[model samples]
Target: MPSSPNLYVYHRGEIIPLEKAFLHISDLAVQRGYGIFDFFKIINGIPLFLDDYLARFYESARLMHLPVLLTPDELKKVLYRLMAQNQIPQSGIKMVLTGGYSEDGYTPAAPNLLITQQPITLLTAAQVQQGIQVITYSYIRDLAEAKTINYSTGIRLQPHMRAQGAQDILYHQNGIITECPRSNLFIVTHDNQVITPKKDVLKGITRKNVLEVAHQKYATVEGVVTLTDLAQAKEAFTTSTTKQILPVVQVDDQVIGNGKPGTVTLDLWQDLLSLEKQQALVRV
Candidate 1:
């Protein structure tokens, strides 16, 4: 269950209750999984890097040829109104663009747009202290650059990950680490340099910010970080809009560097918070 019932959603140019938002049966997004989406977090009642996220959302829609039907300014107005309605200090916002309804065929008519906002729920202090375990899977997300509504690979891994008492699954291909189901993976080398997979992975908003801050202060490398390096690294963590910088104390059955969050991970996590507070767009 969600942490709260106060959800603000926008669909098809109309604001509606979350429960009232529905999709048609013949929608191409439902029938063929033809949809693009983006997710980001809010801070101090303000969305973080919304412009960047929206640009990528538009880019994905262009790649998939889905009609957005709203100008960026119009979309921003709707989004701001939705956020105001929710009235949360911080939240997670998602925008989904789907190929709209069609006849009894694969061809799409227009496109469907949806925006949802939920209160930002953070990991409890206990959870953070105890840390969480992660599992590795062979499933690699398709269209990694474009955040789409379809989640076939992640859906398939959920049951297995839960059965193993894990929170999420990290994906890999050809023995090279790619990313987690919903986060970007990073590792700290023996020399304390942060290493992350290059552009092949999703250019997540939080991931981008974290890397920028890390590079500005600490040594950082963006490249093909192999599974071998990840397993042997001094520390590991995953970054996302929600997770921020969560330490990966364990992978499968192997423990990473005393099976605890490393000093570098803690430093980067603090840096992330400082960066956000510094960059926050003050709200009235």
Candidate 2:
């Protein structure tokens, strides 16, 4: 397991040492795995796209019927203060809303909010250039739209993914491709159209921004993308807050677009980097 920094974490209503931030085993989150979380990057001391992330965080909490005691402004202040206290220039911030300790260990109660920061693991240049391979799994998550604290299925399949020499698993239901376990999937058609699944997937902030960039130049479509679509795609990629835009060279045994990053995928990746730089400049 990756070690957390010896910094302060926002727990309950106070900033506490990371080592001291703990919840009881009777907590609903520990007993029932009931919680929602939102994670975003802190780049050079700036919480990148924090508002969007918070919006989604609150939405997830609301959908799960978990109460978020802090308002957006209050949470922002806490995050900035925690960032200042930690003094980590580039890191990942995760805000969690857990179902508090319940009397019966089954019902929801007052939620506990926890915020922590950790070192960011960036993809190497070669990993971005060569792209990655992902194996397909015929499964769909319950409450697929919410960023819940349940990754049991994905975590359990780690060995299978590793044995297949794949970095991640792309999930589909029946024959329709939904998304990767941790990222959103996109494919470019031979006709130059960009397509991603419209429903049954978490609407990623990075995926939304990528669509914005793609709309500025290419035809973008959101609907069901199937195995046949992947096989016929001229290029493919996945997007997330941490991964940004990563090319998908191969899915299972079929090679995507000559087994390399496609021209469209490269263009979007560059555009995403440009967008990030622009956001960073605005932060400055």
Candidate 3:
């Protein structure tokens, strides 16, 4: 049995203690930083959007030319076993696919898969109501559509973000808004149109659901978004698996729609939370 302090991790074909998981130093994932990963949340013991997350994971592996050894069903079985072993009620599962041990240190070999789960701290409703400020950085992520393990740029900008008293860094190519480091951006135009960038960004599962729900009440567009668009917006927010939906009340020194969480942003937050709870009930 896996003992105290060591969470169970699904590695290759077996579940083992976290400390037992290892990868050779010669692995391309280590030497060249070639790897892909995906994350999904668990609510009330039910994995949220596991299918979507799995699809994304496999797609990332495919894009990176890393072969996935287990089928989707097999991976799900192992994930369930790992979850049962860890018994983390509200947490997130991280799936990593690494370019296997490389003899030449560049070519990808028989890829390695590692899945681990850990507890996550969620934001409170009051905190959501309070909203957060963000700083805009002129940068774009490499391989924007894939969930690659490369977050060097964002991690390097942590100090810059903190100095600006911001919670997250929004990436922009020129004046076009791409996305936040960990979340997708959405802004409601002064005319009440909801828009999120469709290009050069990860297609987040939460963003998809938010769009589906937003379409019922507001006009939605998944297309190009720019800083000028953000500047003229009446409401702004972001979405992610962990963030669910959070309002962005300020960007740099500019106050967003009266410097408070807008009605549209708050309403969408409530709707998304309700949807998640409802899905958890049915899925569990």
Candidate 4:
């Protein structure tokens, strides 16, 4: 969720005003940027991919050594309670687990948990047809698997990316493509193989489902994707919690697959949307 008028957040097991949901100044998340967060959308009061998101959330907590205050079931109850309080039918929820307040501001302690609901805009057909361009950067995240709070590199590169008229950053280390700032990168090869990076990347929930659907028709391969592969790719796309399945028509200055959304990309997008609708119905 981006922003919402709901104005309430679940902070430390209590539902309170968003403005009042503040941590101590000595919190490690504030001082040293120690935290992890996960975001998932709710369509018509039904949470999208709730199980997968929760699994990744707890995995991130485990990797970061942050003890979650509530169990998975307990957290779900809190989230639903928060949603009911907010009264926003279609929105997104963000769960943040921060390194606890530290007297020395360096050591980790009891973790702080927060949950907030906000709004999100889905991509329209027109926008989906047009697609987006991205600039490639040579870097990999420190803790690639964990959805940590450290986004200094990506955020700092935003200005440069926009300056080049690019919508996002496609990160690559050496010659191998890893992922984008907050999304997973996928490329359709000349041989029609759907390929995405297999290592040093966050296993995005959208990416997981994208592969699952892509496997139904295409030869999906979660293997190494290089810069050369992206350059000579037939089609490309990125997936995330927000940007579910967005076409990548251009990388840097090079146009991908005639500089428009490819058939395969669009097909996968429609299929993913259908899957979402089914998931929402099942949840309801």
Candidate 5:
């Protein structure tokens, strides 16, 4: 659905119309780009894995030294209220904690909490089946473990990615692959081990769940992965809140395995879907 005028958003302790939610020009988030955000999906009116998301949100705030104004229970109540007010069956919620407006525009002030929702863009089955192509670049995010409002590099490289006919950018440092611009990268070795980066990457919620399920049946390892490893891998995939588990068929000029989604990748994808279904039921 298109963005509606009637949608509601929660700002601090007050729920207001989405259009009415505003931040000052001198806000640290605007002036200095100091902020943190967490995003989760709402399915069938239930926020999925919301508690986990909230825990990460608070952790990010703590790492950034930004004080969270509300406790988890209080945030949950406000989120549910905003969800009810928006009345969307399937949507995505984003909670932002900003370094609030400061008189000097440089010092940290009280944090401003803002929560908003919009209709979620569901992935098409064909997109999953056909998989996606990615190109690699050598870079790493600063404060990699924290979910900060710093996507300048990723945003700046969008046009280059588009020109290369790739859907996403996989970031590596020196030759060791760290992550994609927006998701965690994983590869299945020919020996059947599921490997992902062990450091300097955002531990995505979906990646956490995928690792939990994958370790039950496959040998899962978190360590340094190199481009040579990807070249020798049987299959590769990515995990994220929005992307779920998507197969990575081609990376730059190298075609992964048979250039199609591998059996292990598909199995993990199914497992993630099953987990989501179970979480949805519990939320209901």
Candidate 6:
């Protein structure tokens, strides 16, 4: 077990301890889930790809017409202060901006901001090392590209997946691969081509980096991949901020590349880990 991390929360225009921050009774985010958020991982005291995460957060807020009450720099200060308050060196931080209190009606209102940080356990490390099985379900969310607070559908699917001994669940709609419940899926062909679900999926930061790195070694890469295409692949993997590069040993009872993490996946994982270390050192 890991040590408990102190939590700092930013609410309204003030920074408060996580235990002290409170939401108003009429906040629409609590009532209707009208909010957007971004998750970031801090490595060696520096946030990995924070700029990209913030950009996405702003984009989500814009799409929902949520006003940007604070600039990015101001938000950065809050994040660092939260980290300091929490005594967090390496952790995961989530910043949530939600529709604030409103009258007795269903309508938009002023927005509220809250940021929280906690230690990241990365519980899937063992699963990554030994590789894990994956199951795909027909669960697709509207506005698949936006990062929002409503994750009930994805949250609801985890129990059913855990009952089957699967590490995660990938979502598909009409035979088209959308994304995994928490991560993005990838596959490598027998011919060394790397394939992933196209722009339809959440263009994950780790996913983007993996594709960029794999381009140097693989001859062909395609983003618009289907279930049929994935099943035919020689190897498969999932990417996320925490998971980094986790190979998929099976997909819905079918073994992927001898039911083990493949050589290409291992190689890419090593490269990504090295890159992370390098980035952390440079930032420090």
Model 6 segments more than 4 A misplaced: 1-6, 123-125, 220-222
Q: Which stretches of candidate 1 lie over 4 Å from their true place?
A: 1-7
> lDDT score of model 3?
0.89
Model 3: what TM-score?
Answer: 0.96
Which candidate do you rate higher for lDDT, 1 or 6?
Answer: 1
Candidate 2 positional error at 108, Å: 0.9
Writing each residue's lDDT as its tens digit, candidate 3 over 30-140 gives 998899999999999899878989999989888887889999998888898999999998999999999988889988888888888888888998989888899999988
lDDT tens per residue, model 1, 94-175: 8998888988649978888989888778665456556578888776667778877767878877888899999878888887
**Tens digit of per-residue lDDT, candidate 6, span 142-209:** 67677878788778878888899998888888888878877888888898888888766667888878
Clashes of 2: 0
Per-model tally of clashing residue pairs: 0, 0, 0, 0, 0, 0
lDDT of 4 at 84: 84
RMSD of each: 2.0, 1.2, 2.0, 1.5, 1.4, 2.3
Lowest lDDT sum, 10 consecutive residues, model 5, at 1-10
Instruction: Give the candidate order by descending lDDT.
Output: 5, 4, 2, 3, 1, 6
Tens digits of per-residue lDDT, candidate 2, 1-284, equal: 34565788999899988988888887899999999999999776787777889999999998899989988998998998999899988899999999998989999888999999897977776789989999999999788889999988889999999999999899988879999888999999999999999989988999999999999999999988998899889999999999998999999999998998889998998898888777866663
Which pairs of residues collide in candidate 3? none
Residue 271 alpha-carbon offset, candidate 2, angstroms: 0.5
Worst 10 residues of 2 by lDDT: 1-10
Higher-TM-score candidate of 4 and 6: 4
- Encode model 4's per-residue lDDT on 70-158: one tens digit a residue: 99999999998898888887788999999989889899989999898887788889988889999999999988999998999899998
Please identify which of the two predictions, 1 or 2, would achieve the higher TM-score against the true structure: 2
